[model samples]
Target: MTLYLLIYFIIIMGAVVAVISKKLINSAIMLALLSIGVSILLFAYNAPWAAVFELSVCAGLITVLFVSAVSLVKHDEENIKENRVKYVLLPLLLIGFIISASIIVPEYFSKLQIFSTYNTQKEEPIGKLIWLYRGVDIIGQLTLLASSVFVIKHIFFKRKEADNGGKI
Candidate 1:
């Protein structure tokens, strides 16, 4: 198998591991690692624009979100209300949905016959293509970056008792 495909497989496994992890902090870190793996795979497949988007939005934005949210929850299982039946049933339902989707979705592009012609010409750099053809998408990405920064700063840097005159 190609290295890119292998990386994708590893990312899938990492995501599964992250989802099942007991500690929320560890799961968040694993998700960041999974995003980095996906970004590297996108870069290897000659989609640097996609790679940058995945790196910034998935890795950076998601990590910031996880860190902010994780801080709100106490790191103790006693605080959690576990429902084993619901947990087991949810996974089974999700597996059924994935199986249905796999059966419905086409594996090869030829099966769908969407494209009329394949272009294999040497293309411009992704940055140039972004500015020329996909400028709107680049602008949207910049907006998202700004919004995420604002949210992160609001969550993590807001004034608290520790900053005011309280002892730790």
Candidate 2:
């Protein structure tokens, strides 16, 4: 319970950093942290297959994409300086949402009989279940990943080539 809560807290913190960072590289690193925290939580909850997928797809492949995109972008120091002063509102908002959800979600879930049913559904071997029943979802995720890589490469490559007098 404490361990799970710690992982969730790390997830929230990493997510907030990912959303609010001014630097693209920082954001990508935070996104990796968020993925790692999520994978840890999924593993702790006994969903190792889901954890592995999340770690590989989200933390590994997606982070590589993000870092590549970040490398292709020019960081404007002026824009970063302008956005640095948030006056604590973002922290307050995140804390408020976390505190509220922590209280309400569990209480609400406890009143439902469906959660108990939901728990039993994951008893099958996760690999068999995912490949058999969730094959379409995997295909979709792969398609999305490939498209993102292509788009990022295309856009950045064009921009760089143009900046270099269209040499290559």
Off by over 4 Å in 1: 2-5, 52-57, 75-78, 88-104, 107-109, 113-116, 120-122, 137-139, 145-168
**Candidate number of the best lDDT:** 2
For each candidate in turn, give its C-alpha RMSD to the true structure in angstroms.
Answer: 4.9, 4.4
lDDT of 2 by residue, 1-168 (tens): 789879988998898887777777888999999999999999998888889999999999999988987776656533555545573468887689979999999889878756464554547676787799889999999999899899979876645576779876
For residue 30, give model 1's deviation from the true position in Å. Answer: 2.2
Residue 87 displacement in candidate 1 (angstroms): 3.7
Q: What TM-score fits each model?
A: 0.62, 0.68
Q: Which prediction has the highest TM-score against the true structure?
A: 2
lDDT tens string, model 1, 75-166? 65557877646644655776898798777776654576875666789878766887899999988989998998999798777466778887
Whole-model lDDT for model 2 versus the true structure?
0.83
Where model 2 places Cα greater than 4 Å from the true spot, the runs are 76-87, 113-123, 131-168
| Cα shift from native, residue 168, model 2 (Å) | 8.4
Any residue pairs clashing in model 1, and if so which?
A: none
